[model samples]
Every structure is written in structure tokens, then in C-alpha cells.
Target: MAAEGKINPMHQFTINQIGPKLEIAGYNISFTNSALWMVLALVVIWLFMLGGMKRELVPGRWQMAVEGVTGFIRNMIDTNIGPEGRRYTPYLFSLFTFILISNLLGMLPLAIVPGFHAFTTTSHFSITGLLALMSFAIVLVVGFWRHGFHFFALFLPKGTPAFMVPVIIPIEIISFLVRPFSLLLRLFVAMISGHILMEVFSSFIVNGLGSSSAIGFGVSLLSFVFIVGIGALEILVCALQAYVFALLTSLYLNDAINLH
Candidate 1:
């Protein structure tokens, strides 16, 4: 009953239209909270990059931040995929920055205003799933381009008993096929789960503060503490999830190149 009342926690996940609603045949094309936040994330990245481009003897804060993030991803690609992976850094860099920003932006309190809105773009499976699929596609192209028919050899290791080939080959193929789904589920579920937990606590705080009982006041204080602790955890999760996705992507690319 508490969960079903005016304090419904899941309401936070609703994606509402921001402006004029529009749709084409069999498609919902309206500009929504999700679209708005994506553009915001893109603009933030673009502006930060531009600011970071300033040529001073001592780099400004933006420049330093940009350099640090660039160097971090640079090292990641180098270690996971080797020097050959240098060419692919831009894609991975953008993925990390976009995802990190989206997750952080989702935690902001700006949506309390009536007309304004905020959304967690990563919480939606569509965004993360599409990115995962693209990463997998890149792996396929790189694999086939480098090794041609030998790329299929990845499904069967270099040596195996001929009789065992029947069993091992299918197992390898299944695992390889499952990578994108695994990536999508990990990122999407993490984002949504954190957001849902935070929202539930937020609702508890609101409900408690509104109640007349002393117990409700104590509950509100407890809920506030939980929100703070969960928020710290969520910050770690936001960065960790982005890093893990990029690392997994680099490993996938390495497999494509070397068939590991």
C-alpha cells in the first residue's frame, strides 16, 4: 500500500515529453526528457573539449581534466589492446565521458522545477544496448578484416582433439555470441538499479517529513542518511561501470584482432 500511494518511487523513471510531441507512422518521435539529457551530455563534452584545447603554458582546470581523462583512457587502450589500439581511442573516450556524465546528471535535483526535466540516459536499455551492439560490430569488422576466414577460427582454438571439436566449438561460439547481451545487461541494469534505489529513499524522505508522527521524523532522518551513503556508492558505481565497459570493449577488440 505504501508503495502504491502518491509517493510512488518508480515515477522517477517515467520519460515525459519536453516540448511539442511529434510522431511519424508507427513511431514515437517526440522530443523527450531522454533526448534532452543526451543533447546536454553531448554539449557538455563538446564544450569541455573546446575549453581543454586552450594553449597556455599552464593548463586551466578544464584542460587538465581533459588531459587526465584522455591519458587515463589512453593507458587503458594501450594496456588492453596494445599500441595498435591507439587508433580506436576516440570511440572509447567518448563512450566513457558520455556514460559518466549521463549517470552523474541523473542524480541532479533539477527536475523539481515544473517545466524543467532531467533523465538518466543510461538507465534505458535502448541507449546502452545500441552502444554494446556497435562495439560488437566493430569487433566483427576488425576480426574479419584482419584475419579473413581465419577469423572464424576463433570459434575453435588452435588445437583440439578432432572429436572434442564438436563440443568445444559450439561452447566458444555461444559465449562469443552472448558478449553484447552481457554488456548491455550489466550497464543498463546497474544504472537503473542505482537510480531506483535512490528514488525510493527520496520518496521515503518526502513521505516521512510530511507525516505528523515522531517516528516519521526519525524515519526521514534515517532516509536522508541512507541517501547520502547510497549517493557516495552510486558515484563510485558511475565511474566504475564506465571504466568496466570500456575495458571490456578493449578486450573484445583485442580478441577480434588476435582471436584470444
Candidate 2:
């Protein structure tokens, strides 16, 4: 029979200590897959920007490609959030690039297992949650910075009937608080689901061959083909999720500035 005590697919992505460690606040402080991926993502960003910033007149192929990505994010911000939102372009660009690199790196076969079978960092909610929180903080800080106490008026739509104000204000407050929750859950669930589905499908192929006398090799081959297709789909999803996150952030900031 298959192993009775299989690890939870969900738990595979959780943050845990990598070595013996102690914390002053009674929390575990240890190296984790999430930290590793964060470092990897930063390294990828630095290298890409370094190569792209050479500013050659002829424009090397690598520089051109990087410029395309930068231009795309620029246009997205300009078009969706307008000229007033242009100041946020740098943050959006970095957010999208880091996520794109992290997702793509996780899809690589070598990354599926690193340094003696460690869990992939992309599967961890803590990492994804921290990313979501950072975006949330940006929105709050920028909005308040620009508008001061007037930003609080964002939760109270202008010209609402006095009687309806009480009802609508609370609802608005709840929705605002839920933004980070939605952001964290959406990315975490999407990434974890994709990874787990791939694992299950691959495992089935291996198990089928070992258990059956029939032409299980063909089944395994077909499963492998499906895995490749799913991988391509996941890449598209990674980009889409990143875009959705940035788009939502822009929308929130726009609302704070009373643009719409």
C-alpha cells in the first residue's frame, strides 16, 4: 500500500527551521526555504537590472528584453493609474519582476528539490503573506502620506445619505481590512495548488508502473506529457497573478486619492 502517513501537500510549503537555533522572543529563528527563495529572487533582479542598465546605444539583446519588461510595467501603471500614479512605477515594477522570477525559478526541475530534498520556497504561505503585507503597507503609507487624515475619508464615500453612512462605513472598513487577506490567500492557494497537482500526477505515473504488469510505461509517458502542459499553464498563471496583485494595488491607491 502507499505510505499510510504521507505528508500533507499543504504542509510541504510551510516555513520551518533548517538547523538548531534559538530566539530571544521565544520564536524559532532559522534558515528556511522561503528565505533562500527571497535571496534568489533578489539576486535575479540585481543581475537582470545590471545587465539592462548598461545603456548601450545599439542595445544588446539582453538589454532590449529587460527594457521590454520595464516598459510593459510602465505602461500598465500609466494606463491604469494615470500620470498621477507614475510615482509608484518603481515599486510595481520591482514587485512584478520579483514574483515573475520567483515563480519561474520554482518551475525549474532542479528547484523542485534543493540541497538534499528541501521543500520548495514557493509553496510557503509565510513568504507569500509577507509579500502581500508589503504591498498592503505601501498602499496604507502612501495614501496617508499624500492625503493625511483625509485618507480616512476613503472608507466613507462622499455624499452618502446620513442614515446609510453607518451601514456603508462599516462594510467599507471590513473590506479594506480584508485586502491583505485576499492578496495573501490568492497567491498562496494558486501556487500551492499548481505544485501539488503536479506532484500527485507525477507520483501516479511512478506508482502505476511499479504496481502493474500492463503497459504502464505508456501511462507514465502520457502523464509526463500532461505535466509539461500544466507547467506551461502555470507560467501564464504566475504572470497573471502578479499582474492582478499590482492592478489591485493601483486601484486601491487610486481610490484613496479619490480619482474614482
lDDT of each: 0.88, 0.77
Compute each candidate's TM-score over C-alphas: 0.93, 0.86
Which pairs in model 2 have colliding backbones?
none
lDDT of 2 by residue, 1-260 (tens): 13553334454465666566768688877776667777888998999999999999999998998899888887887777788888888888888887777877777776344433334454567767887888888888877887898888888887889999989999999999999888888877888899888877777677667667576777777888988999899989888888887778777767765533
Model number with the top lDDT: 1
TM-score of 2: 0.86
* Model 2 score (lDDT): 0.77
lDDT score for residue 28 of model 1: 81
Give the least accurate 10-residue stretch of model 1, judged by summed lDDT: 1-10
